[model samples]
Target chain A: MKSKAKDLTDEELHQIVEKAKAKDNRALGRLCEHFYSKIYRFIYYRVNSIEDAEDLTSEVCLRVVKSLPEQKGLFYAWIFRIASNMITDYYRRRAVRSNVTSTGDLIEEMVDEKRTTGELLEQQELRQAIKHLTEEQQQVIVLKFIEGYDTDEVADLVGKSAGAVRAIQFRALTVLRNMYVRKDGKS
Target chain B: MEQNIELLLDNCIDEIRKGKSIDECLADYPQYEDVLKPLLQLAVQIENLPQPNPSSEALSSALINLGKEMERNTAAAEISEAIVPSQRDVLPQKGFAASMKKRKTFSFFSEGSFRNVFRKSKLAWALSTFLFFAVVLSAVTVSANSVPGDILYPLKLATEKVKFFLTFDSYGKAELRLNFSDKRLNELVEVLQQSKTLDTSLLKDMLDEAKLALEENEIPVEKASILTAKLNHVNAYQKTVLENIRPEVQATDRKIVDDAINVCDMRSRWMRRMMNEEYQEQYDEQDTTPQSQTPNRKRHQPKRMQWGEGCDWMR
Candidate 1:
């Protein structure tokens, strides 16, 4: 379906959000349709499984439908915040259930079914490198590079200063480069 | 040293995102080339990394789930709206100036001045109080015999609802509901007698509500006996009406009519028996009175008691 929200300007997006707050099902449906792929993609990158990503994406949409009336910030930020929290909770629950300590072990449990053999190996290596970084560093890198958010947007989402976000990204890139070099040397 | 490099790297990345080569970007800042080169290369690699795209199946599934959630929310909102209409529905939709004028006119009553006049003048207060009750009593009396087709029928229903609202205890509410149920049957009978088309659904709903009230067993046997007498009256009318319209009524409506008639028959017979037991006890009490004191009156009393016993069915 063509998303009514995708073509909407900022003012039009705000209008749709207002209509959604008034319980307009059509507007809410449009918003859900527009945001579903983005949210699912973000969750897929984090969880590495289509099924889990689909489930969490629906959960985020449900929360958005419920909390949209009370929300008082940028719509994208609010939505991403909910997705981020859900991802955190998912990991927390999985960690508790499996009692696993290593991030590689967690990633191993969530193999991407879509990738070919070589692509899967490269992705696994990339995820392994990302998993070694601190959680804050990983978030900055994902938001800036993967999600294509600006420094200020990343700062706002991560609750850090813009400069701090840049610093995190710089350090994250340096560490990731070293890890890639090491992996190449080993090979 | 680190802050300048971070700033320079941020600028370099911005330039790269805007379509600048690493060599061109480094040409402007050769001093930081060695440090910036690897980092910029990694940035480009990260940017080019294979980000996962949600499958079409996943997207469609999430949309379906979201649609269901929105539907559930809309249904809940509709139900709430039906139960309690919003302020916009209840209040007048006049402009602000009109509302302000109304507020001004009512301001005297809202403040203590009008209340003080009523408080200070005893006769004025008493007269106002009497007028209020008189108007209410007259409205209720005028609306008492109003049937479904009558203009006063809505008023009658509203009055009954007010009574239902005022009655606190479960048994009281049940009895009132039963009374309203009897009224519904009376309305149905009136419509039939006038040869007007009857509202079978309304009658059915009222009968169902009445049955629910009786099944609750909230009222005492004595109180229920009165309802039983009313039910018998309804039963007699329902039977007569059903017999008159049996050929003309649709099959579906006939079933509803039949169920109502059956309920009336069952409940009325039970109530008659209960009333008989009660009246019999009363007759026994009167029988113990001395026959020597008034012999002629005592002889006639048993006949009178028997007549009263049969009269319960008529009621």
Candidate 2:
């Protein structure tokens, strides 16, 4: 499902950061509601675990709160840096558990749901197709289509040049189209 | 530019943007228009996958944990300032008491004073005194005269020269001259033995020729020279080394004949080394620069380090 564009704009988010740095709890709460789903989904795709994603998403919000005291709170790149660190740390903890064990297990858990019959069947097919896509394609597609971050924002969050992100996005879309499209007689 | 595929994908994105339902995403993407109906149905199913939103509690807990870390860091800073002592604060440092500190170092040592001279280490004092007496004694000895041990010196020298002479060859009255002891015969045998190509019996014949090598044409009493002669003689005697004594005789005789010359050379060199130790300065004076030595200093010696100060033999 698509997200409603929030009432607050990017500039408002900037102000909320400044106010939060000044210890404005209400403003910090507003900031949380705005980016909460985003931070959650970004982590969900990365760790592919409900528990870990929840933990890491909260971890990102906490870091924003703690670090804001010293931060001038110009968080365009910095806020995501905190989120990135959390996601990175989450992976580190998970890595020690058993060997990654299964790449799709956690993502599957995060995305699995009860659905109508046709939708469910179609979803299984698409999920299978997604599973076949390369890891980088999955990441880019999630960062763009899933998280709804613009290409450049996603690039900054992912620590890659925007043009490179665009390239990855293009390739990812192409792969999705090819698999989901399923041309004329053959699967 | 089929742009057909690109436009199709764009329409699909637009359909998703409008929330037309995931069903329309594939149909709107004209690139897959041929199979868009089925693909869209599949896409809808995928869109239905539950994306669990992280709970509100997680966010609050994260905030609490972060607050704790910040408080901990602040406490650490405050504690650091409290512990560090400033110089202006007149409290005496318990770790560095002035009374227990070592005395200041001297810039240079005292010169020509009794205290300074005697205060030198005992080893240094002993070495200096010994060197002083030795130098004085050596100077006086040079002023007077002394002699090298002359008794049997000529015999020792003659023996060496004779040994060296035997290494080369010369002739005598006999056509096929042979004598291991005669200097000339020894030389001839050396040439024969060293030849790369020669008759097998050449050595045997040469040994027989050793009979006349001595001064009175009589054999010397010394068994060493006689053995040396026979060792190379090739024909001196028919002893066959007497098979019963094979191993012992071979080891003794071979070691003597083979290793004797090398052993003598080494011993002579050692003797020269000892004599040089006794009269090195005299030899230095006589031939100061047959080839000028650059310096015998070790590579690690600094420019300021003096040879006399740390010379290995100063003691």
Candidate 3:
């Protein structure tokens, strides 16, 4: 669905979203398919397990489909907000926020054929370092960088001001840079 | 200010997303390049982190589940719509939440509406069950006082039949039947008192029940005395009651009344015979005198009244 989503213009995407809001199943399927990879990646990077990300992604999609009719604002914001909430609920239910990203599991998640092992290891380190940031900082980094959502959009999804989102992004990046420097120095 | 540099870093990241080189933007803010470059490069690398696609199996399964849920919801909405047409306009505006709320509020007669409807129906069923028992109890109560032609009189008869069958012991059954016979006589009197035409069949039934009570097979000897005494008393009362009502009967029904009196008379004779036999047996057992001198046992005999004198003989 995300593959199909890449080829479609903004207008076509908007039409599909509108049809989904009207309970058109085909359009809803397209919408879910389009966001599936993105939502999965968003959850996967934040959570420790691939299964958890897949489950949370599906949950977020279903909630979006059900609540679409009553949705009043931007669809992206609404959907990401649902995904964010699902992740929070997952952690709350588990009662422990474990960041156990084994190299074997990270290697399995590498879908890109051209990515070198060094890049993969770097990405893994980035993911591990991201977990050490505050919850708000992690959300800001994931929303702002990984999802490529603008400051205002990230702020809307996370229920904060644009200025706050910007500050969080900066602090999150600074912390990550420090972690990378320390790791390099230790090596 | 630290806040300014944060804003500037965000501005540079926005430029990088828009295709401006990160190094070109860092050059513009030359003084903060050292602090901002690593952060910007890390941000770019994090953004470059490979996005994972959901497995096709999981995606399709999730989609199928979503479709099924939507179908169920649509079906529910259609049923809810059919039940309450006025709320149709509200469903589209407020969606499933509003439709469900409307259903709870207005779907009184819908079979599949809300849990509360089932609860209300259960309460109704309980109330109806209570009402049914109450009606039966009231009918039995009313039937207790009903005469032959009253609406509830059949109920009274059925109740008596139930009581008769429920009595397991033969003596108890006979007693109950005899009591029923007495009730019939009372009803006959009540009919006469009200000047209603007496049902002759009812009178016959009463006599038949009395005969059955006195003629039950192999009554125990111990209970026989008590049963015989009760029969004698009932027969006397029946004869007196029959005689008392004879003048009140119309000329055409007088024959049936006479027949009833005759049955009462026969019952009295049979009772007297039984008593005589019993006394004779006792005398035979107690006799210590010679058999030739037994004729003198007339001195021990109790005085008996003549049967021709009617109920006065029984008293």
Best by DockQ: 3
Residue-level lDDT tens digits of model 1 in B163-199: 8889886567766776776677677767766764657
Worst 10 residues of 2 chain B by lDDT: B298-307
lDDT of 2 by residue, B1-315 (tens): 334444454456457656775455554345566544443443334344555466656654554454344334433433344333222222222322231122112111112222322333334546667878898556544532211233443443344355446644322222123332243323323433454222223223333333233222222223323333333332222223212222432343433222323322333343344344435544564476556655332211111212222122211
TM-score top scorer: 3
Model 2 residue A16 distance off true place after TM-score fit, in angstroms: 1.2
lDDT of model 1 at residue B23? Answer: 86
RMSD of 3: 18.3
Per-candidate local distance difference test: 0.66, 0.46, 0.73
**Model 1 chain B: lowest-lDDT 10 consecutive positions:** B298-307
Q: Is the docking of candidate 3 incorrect, acceptable, medium or high quality?
A: acceptable
Residue B73, model 3: lDDT of: 63
Error of 2 at B133 (Å): 70
Superposed Cα deviation of residue A89, candidate 1 (Å): 1.0
- The DockQ figures for the candidates are 0.20, 0.13, 0.24
Candidate 2: fnat, from 0 to 1? Answer: 0.29
> What TM-score, computed on C-alpha atoms, does each candidate reach?
0.50, 0.39, 0.51
Ranking by lDDT: 3, 1, 2
- What is candidate 1's fraction of native contacts? 0.53
